[model samples]
Target: MNTNVTPLTTVSRGGDAVLFAIEMRGKKLTCSITREALEAHFWLERQANEARLLRAFSDGRKRIVAIAERKARRLATEVIKLTSQDFER
Candidate 1:
């Protein structure tokens, strides 16, 4: 399975997470990282608005996407949701 994670990222609809796209086997999949994960791992502030959350995600995009890709490979799912626990290792 070939996978490529794009740099394009956006805040989730509810503004509680950041969503990004992953292209795998000619299909696009959506993945997300919770605001809690951003706060704990990506230095996001409490009650941050969409802008701040997006900035945090952009700043940590590389690491975040790497983890998301790993999860996607291991779990083999169409959607990946990364929480704070995903970064524990």
Candidate 2:
């Protein structure tokens, strides 16, 4: 798949939304996220900051969570395709 999506963001009082646009094979596709589900991503990305406060922690040897995030990324990727599955009223 020749796919590349650069996320652009807009922040507001309620929350944020990311826009992804793609052009491929003479076709244009756009994805608008009304209410971004950011909890999982924010939490996962906070490991570096949290490390300073905690003295000891586990490295999460098992990669169970990757399975879920992988699926999540796939869903988000599909949005760039402008697939009906990601459309919202």
Candidate 3:
């Protein structure tokens, strides 16, 4: 499978930055931004999926959908570590 990786965004809190990965196909991508970047990535994925569904056939779109889902899940898990609530748990 052809894979392309690119840095999407990054979230910074305190002196540390949390990087979020944007994986496409088998490729993995990451970057650093502010906490708002996480939310933006989620929103961007939603919009892109909507556009993709309208333009691509169902059978050809699963890979992109899966990639987005996987990235979102991974990002959420990592973000938890940067939160104060993580220590409380």
Best by TM-score: 1
lDDT of 1: 0.87
Rank order by TM-score, top first?
1, 2, 3
| Residue 7 Cα positional deviation in candidate 1, in Å, after optimal superposition | 5.2
TM-score of each: 0.86, 0.32, 0.23
The numbered model that scores best in lDDT is 1
- Residue by residue across 3-81, what tens digits does model 3's lDDT show? 3434333333442334445454454544333223222332223323333322322332244334444544677532223
- What would the per-residue lDDT of candidate 2 be over residues 1-89, giving only the tens digit for each residue? 34333343223333333344443334445543323223232222332332321111122211212322333457554333221233222
In the order shown, the candidates' Cα RMSDs to the true structure are: 1.9, 10.8, 14.4
Off by over 4 Å in 1: 1-3
lDDT of 1 at 29: 77
Residue pairs in collision within model 2:
none
List the pairs of residues colliding in candidate 1.
none
lDDT of 1 by residue, 3-42 (tens): 7878788887778888899887786778999999999998
lDDT of each: 0.87, 0.31, 0.35
The parts of candidate 2 lying over 4 Å away from their true place are 6-15, 41-89
